[model samples]
Target: MSGLLFAALIVATPFLLQAVSPGDANWGKLSEISQAYGAVSVPLSAAALAGVVASLAYQARQTRIAQEDAHRSTHRELILLALASPALRPCWEPPFVPMTSAEWERIAFTNLIMSGWENAFRLGSLSDDQLRLTLRGHFSGAPARMHWANARDSWIELVEHGTDRRARDFARITEECFQAAVLAGPGVQAADYFIPEPTNGAGGGGS
Candidate 1:
């Protein structure tokens, strides 16, 4: 309503000026200008309304994009934090996570080490690329499957029903990607791999 009124005022301003401006303003010319202004006002007002609508639409789009970027940024920060400390890796190995799971099984993890993986898995959006890398590149397959199977009930309780869809799918996708990586092994592109349904938490369990 305000926008329409402002536009109407702009269109009306010129006619008002010509009509009221002191003396000697030809009445004949004033009448002609009034007619012209009347003819153009509606189109000018419509254009103004369109500009307002377009600005609102643009602002809405930017707001959504900002939210998504913030989501991804949160995941990135958590990934960096999880990998920051050397104390988390006592025995040493390249590219921790999946291998860390094996290392953990061989010689159980202290609470500190366990915490690193916890932040890596739980802090950010699951679909985040870094999170996916931590899952598929570092921890997928038998290791992730085994861990998830053991923790399923606890995780379900944590997430409950209203949890974010990305986080929920993250749990399921990590397990699937892990199985796929195990099947593919070295040299095959993981993307070329197919995910197998979780198999009864089969094979064996490790610490």
Candidate 2:
């Protein structure tokens, strides 16, 4: 029970005692009432503690979701950047066809895209499955696969020279996607195994 309720009960004790024995004015009834009401406090305190724990757990879950959303937003922005910026296009550029282009522009774009992917990984924006799906878009054709195959050296280079583990992280998945693309060969299209999630339409293989 609340302190105010307990206090009110205590205040009424004198009247109860007066009524119990008007002439004797017994005070023992007041003691009994106080003990009875005080016993309710333990259960009340436990319930209050449970409520606080539940509230904190809810707040922690909300905070975790907010952070995940922020990371996902960052990843989405990176994908959208590829849409407008020629330097950051998600698909293979011209002259490369179904594979990596020897063209300087395509190489530069690949480098930039991989760097962004590394950052996204470091930020915990993309899960391994999401990253795999995102990488699938780059294997749009022979040129895309060629680009990944050709860029393998540089991806390793970044891992070797990087200060953070981000480059290493990207390199791990980069190798996986590049190998998968190579194994799939020129016949394997982006539509073959690429299904985009609705949450990130920015560079979804579907898009």
Candidate 3:
């Protein structure tokens, strides 16, 4: 009986040792796999952060470009206003009447108001005879002979008392007229019809 038991113990010992060793090896391999995954995650996270930062920078550049475009557009509108003012007839001196620089500036300012109002009417922002009627009504009590300065002051007064809607409409019409005048060229005639004076020298005639 002792001999048979000893033989059975020897067979079972090999099987037990094999099972314990495989379990320990598997646990070690799992730990190594976990460590590798942890190492890979750090690089991926850093790459994602870089991508997010790059996207924000691109958006900021686009916003800056849009703002600059708007500023340039406003500047262009102002330039058009300057160019349109010189082309109007009331701003010009007649062949017989020579005007001083100050006189011309005053006339130009007055004409600018009239031209602005007339353009507003033509654009359908104001009625056909609205400005004319307003002026007539204001000056009805005054003398028949009125200077350009008086007309300009009266127009400015009327504008001040006018609705905010009219003011906005006038601004819009002014921009539109300026754009049209620019496209038509400096020599193109508008409603006021100012003929350009002949150039005397390389410097060109005074405005």
TM-score of each prediction = 0.34, 0.39, 0.30
Task: Please identify model 1 stretches exceeding 4 Å from their true place.
Answer: 1-29, 86-207
Model 3 whole-model lDDT (C-alpha atoms): 0.53
State, as a TM-score between 0 and 1, how close model 1 is to the true structure: 0.34
Q: Which regions of candidate 3 deviate over 4 angstroms?
A: 1-25, 86-207
Question: Using lDDT as the measure, what is the rank order of every candidate, best first?
Answer: 2, 1, 3
Which regions of candidate 2 fall more than 4 Å away from where they truly are? 1-102, 161-163, 187-207
Worst 10 residues of 1 by lDDT: 106-115
Model 2 misses residue 152 by how many Å?
1.5
Candidate 3, position 25, lDDT: 64
Lowest summed lDDT across 10 adjacent residues in model 3 is found at: 138-147
- What tens digits encode model 2's per-residue C-alpha lDDT throughout 10-122? 99977886777768644687678878888998899999999999999999977965886688567666645664575665453343234332343444555556656766787
> Could you give candidate 1's per-residue lDDT for residues 1-207 as a string of tens digits?
999999999999878987879778787887899899998998999999999999999998679657856875675554445456545544333332344444344223222332344444554533356655665655433434444445555555655564465556555655565566667764333344577767776667787
lDDT of each: 0.57, 0.67, 0.53
Q: Of 2 and 3, which scores higher on lDDT?
A: 2
Compared to the true structure, candidate 2 yields what TM-score? Answer: 0.39
